[model samples]
Target: MSIIAVVGDCTTTTALALAAGWPSGHDAVILEADRTGGSLAAWLGTPASPSLSTIVANSPALGNSPSTAWSAVDAMVRHAPSGTRFIAAPVRSRAASRALSEAGGTLFPLLAQLYEPTIIADIGSYAVADAPSVLFSLASSIVVCHRQDAASAGAATVRLERLAELVQFLATFGVPLTVALIGDRPFGPDEVGQFLTADGQAEIVMHSLPVDDLTAAVFAGRTGVSERRLARLPLIREASALARQVAPAETDRAPDSSRIDQLGSSR
Candidate 1:
């Protein structure tokens, strides 16, 4: 039950689209937690009925208990054509935006606790505000998606600095932070990661998603490509790789007998 927060310096919709294609073995949900708004409803051509706005507006009646709050969030979830479930952002009214500001910190912390499904949240860009920064404390993994070219790379560095600042306060939890490069370039993931890692700018896991316009269109609901065909695309393959890298199985790790014995003794 890990919460993987996908955020960026620029638009993260494409990154979210790629993430939505991850090979989900468990129940997975994409949450549009961007305080500004979410475009998933429009992209998937689904009505914004059960959205974040709906949950926030109903929060008052739902009571302050974690169960009630989670119930409200659960009810708002809608499944996409791609088999990805999501809670959309507000589109019609600005009230939902306000709701996110007022209660986002509290509500999302509860969702992060649900262990059944892996919550891949499209948190948009990082912000200094509590609404967006709260996830830095709760998320098991934080992927800062950014463009890889020269210009955007500079901006990405700035964004990473901001993210580092936020994570510093929560470092004791050992949250895994990653920088996911989106777009094509001569630089490989390791090369870019090395440059960023130099000078201890910030240590981060590096991942890449090649620019595949066709696959992007399919994820954006712009094409009529079948799911099987879409699955074969380079975009999907890279996303799958990134997903596996970000969340590998516990069995893939070597056993730490000493740590196990220590835990046993403590118990």
Candidate 2:
């Protein structure tokens, strides 16, 4: 089973959407731990309520019914259009941060039980060692999304530095981290990756999500056009290739692998 943990900003939700749409019925879930903008809900079609919040608040009493929990999960799943399943975090990422701080590596395996062999987490800036958001230790693969310019590049560099500092922290917990760099279309994979690494970056196992029409599909909530185009694009292909690196078999892959659009490199 591959547990993909994403650590980045709110745009991470869009990344998850892309991951979901990579193929039809990608058996994946999103933990909308980013509580600031309700970005996950925005991506999930308009939600009826903060039911994820309610569930986290009431889980102890409700026996944490997977059926009921799954109800909320289902609502968001509808917005997905792709075959991905998701659950926003208990509250904001900060709250989940607390849970992570207290629990160590507990939430992922339990959540893993409810899904398929592959799991993708839209983790935020919480990859740090002990301040507490989420742990990189739980990830089979850790993808960090960032831009290429100095500001974003600088941030990515810091994150890479932090990820290194905390390697042992996660290794102790059984997490294997492989870092990737994501950028928009204006930036080429080689260009962004090279600039970032020019200064001797963290041996970044890096690649990028080049800007293209697919992002428009995500925003308009009708990505079929972009999805079709991207099904052949290098960004998606590289993502698939990386995904397969960690998880090879079809069952090991997200549902997107089954799609006709998947590029050879992706598989």
Candidate 3:
């Protein structure tokens, strides 16, 4: 159904939490599209092959249709012990970056075709110059995750400004952009909003995820928390609520002509 790109400073863990907490009746897959690198294979103990690199290597052989693209991607999907399905990126930074660069023009467009399972792409730490712009252009929604601290907020502001510029260039003003604040701190959503909007960036929706290190550790494959217990954690509960809010309903699906045309031209 929908492709939600999660980006910002240190968003891999936050993105994982969102994917794991997706509401019931909806099937979601985490696509580790981090340009820098990915740690899911090592973190979740999943296999290293049949990854993004595999998809990139095999892209030319696949048809341009959505069904064909979905099939190529589905074959590489792997499941973690926690029951989350994900497509891992290469572990090494150079390999990962190279794969993305080689496939940047096509990988996300192929991903855009699928409409069955919702995709939550963990696009860690968006860079204005080198980051793939097509990913943001085609995304149904974008969530910028950051901590409450001053440093993280400052970094998020910079990314948001870059995103504002990209959105303007692509003319994708309809796409929803959200700022998700991680953990508790002295400042709240209002203060965070003020900080983000002070620079006159695009309008952004605000959200928060609780601090639950134990549950996060479980997600990292560092703990033995049971599924039932994990679901009850504050972090999971809030993430589920957030997922419900951001993910579009099945009936609401409709092709945005401008975005589709933009994708064609970008290619």
Candidate 4:
């Protein structure tokens, strides 16, 4: 049940995942399914598993005729660790999460059942009406990946509505969401506050992942999990705690928001 969905732009999520100690050589994991292949794949240097194109090519495995060609999809997930796996909807931005219907909500949790402690899903940057909602429907916590600019956060804020509706609709699945913001540069909470206006508000929750030198080290294939864990200071620790709180539980209820210290870093 220690599963989290890292949503939004993949441009910086690889760094965010490493900062959070995913696949951290512990009871943690980071699973990626990006068709162009995300920064995580390059960071981890793992091999190519099946992709959206792979599933698209094999659509008949899930449903009707082969000639129908990608009208339907079979979400392709691959076991990356004993208790962690990677799944990405290989279609273009809008089509990314479409595999939810093909795999059902069971796809993520099924891997979680096998992978156990933690699962980080890298959902690339596309918050369309269809697939992102489906992925959010499956997430225990969603790391809303944004850049450190005013615009990306602005986009993230607007996208929060779709997230709210999806969470409400997925009641039968059971799991509230915690939202974490990931950016490439450093920005204080006050600066972030400016963009997070009421129009951008969504009820699930939010957190920040700090950008740092060691962060770059980890993603550059320089450090291992044991080497980098707890190195980003408070931001890293808070992220791990939030991941735990959201991952293990499945219900409309989320961990108490007030008690959770929203963590970040000093410039």
User: In model 1, which runs have C-alpha deviations exceeding 4 angstroms?
Assistant: 9-20, 60-68, 92-96, 127-132, 150-173, 184-186, 248-267
User: Cα lDDT of model 4 overall?
Assistant: 0.44
Per-residue alpha-carbon lDDT of candidate 4 for residues 1-267, written as tens digits (9 for 90 to 100): 345665554334442433243322333344454433444434444454465445544544543332222223223444332222344344343444354444444344344333344556665555445334444555655555544554565565555455444434433345554445555334454444443434443344556655444544544455334422434355445555555445444322332221111111110
Q: Whole-model Cα lDDT per candidate?
A: 0.61, 0.48, 0.69, 0.44
All candidates' TM-scores? 0.76, 0.61, 0.81, 0.52
Worst 10 contiguous positions by lDDT, candidate 1 = 255-264
lDDT of 1 by residue, 1-267 (tens): 567777764334544443444444445577776766778887766887778777767767655665666676777788665455778877633654675665555677666665646677777765445543566667887777766555566675665556556444334446777777776454567766676666563557877767777765655666556555655667566676666666535312222223212212222
Best model per TM-score: 3
The candidate maximizing lDDT is: 3
Error of 2 at 186 (Å): 12
Range of the 10 consecutive residues with the lowest summed lDDT in candidate 3: 258-267
In candidate 2, which residue ranges exceed 4 Å CA deviation? 9-14, 21-26, 35-37, 48-51, 61-79, 90-109, 112-117, 127-130, 150-174, 183-204, 213-227, 248-267
Which of the two candidates, 1 or 2, achieves a greater TM-score against the reference?
A: 1
RMSD to truth, every model: 9.6, 6.5, 8.7, 9.5
